[model samples]
Target: EAGVAQSPRYKIIEKRQSVAFWCNPISGHATLYWYQQILGQGPKLLIQFQNNGVVDDSQLPKDRFSAERLKGVDSTLKIQPAKLEDSAVYLCASSPRDSANYGYTFGSGTRLTVV
Candidate 1:
């Protein structure tokens, strides 16, 4: 199966700068997820979407982070005024609506470093 696609595999930004990452899910996937992975820790779900609507975003830092899945195919995640603590890998994943049976396909992720 084809994997999800993410751009700018690495990024380095000064503190308080802004950055954005883009993702293209596998064809036919209806569910999408964005995750943040800090060093030595498991990935944390930042946002989730089913089709074009948001399913959950409780973990997303609204004050500094935002995401959208327009048309339910492509997605983007952005962080503004980034902090050192936000330096982590931003991962994008996708799955079918009935994903529990098939599992999710993840992208290589964008590594952001806040100086």
Candidate 2:
């Protein structure tokens, strides 16, 4: 079973630039979720997709953040007009929980730093 995959491992951008991150969830997993974690706080769910259909995205910051899970597999999360407060770790995780339960298969995240 391969673990989740995230890209760049790190990123730095100006306060209003746009950036995107990619993810590949584990094999055979039907549920995928993207989360933003601040320096000290716990991981916060941004969006969740199940087989290309969204299950939950209430916490997603639509003003600047958007994501997609086309083909019901891989995914990408984007942030446009990034802000200084957007610096955080973007994590991608998957579980057998379908859409009701959640767990952490924590991967090396894309650490975005806004300047």
Candidate 3:
């Protein structure tokens, strides 16, 4: 099975700088998700999208972070004025609309470092 694709496997930036990450989900997937995984901690759901519409974004820091799924195929996440606590691996995952049986497909993730 094909996997999700993420760009810039790693990144480094000074605090308060801006950065962006991209993701391409598996073909035919209707649900896409973005997560933040801090070192030694479990992944936290940042946002979720069903096709081109947002399904959830309660966890996203709207003041500093934003994301969009264009045409329901590709997605991008951006963070402006990043903070030290923002240093984490930004993971992209995808699944079918009713994917309760099949688990999610995850990308290698973009590791961000805010010093």
lDDT of 2: 0.90
lDDT of 3 by residue, 54-114 (tens): 9899999999999999999999999998999999999999998756578789999999999
Clash list (residue pairs), candidate 1: none
Query: Can you tell me which runs of candidate 1 are displaced by over 4 Å?
Result: none
Clashes of each: 0, 0, 0
TM-score of each model, paired residue for residue: 0.96, 0.93, 0.96
Q: Give the number of colliding residue pairs in candidate 2.
A: 0
Ten contiguous residues with the weakest lDDT in model 1? 95-104
Better of 1 and 2 by TM-score: 1
Model 2 Cα displacement at 100 (Å)?
A: 5.5
lDDT of 1 by residue, 16-36 (tens): 999999999999999999999
Angstrom error at residue 53, model 2: 0.7
The positional error of residue 38 in candidate 1, measured at the CA in angstroms, is 0.3
Off by over 4 Å in 3: none
Candidate lDDT scores, in order, read 0.94, 0.90, 0.95
lDDT of 1 at 58: 97
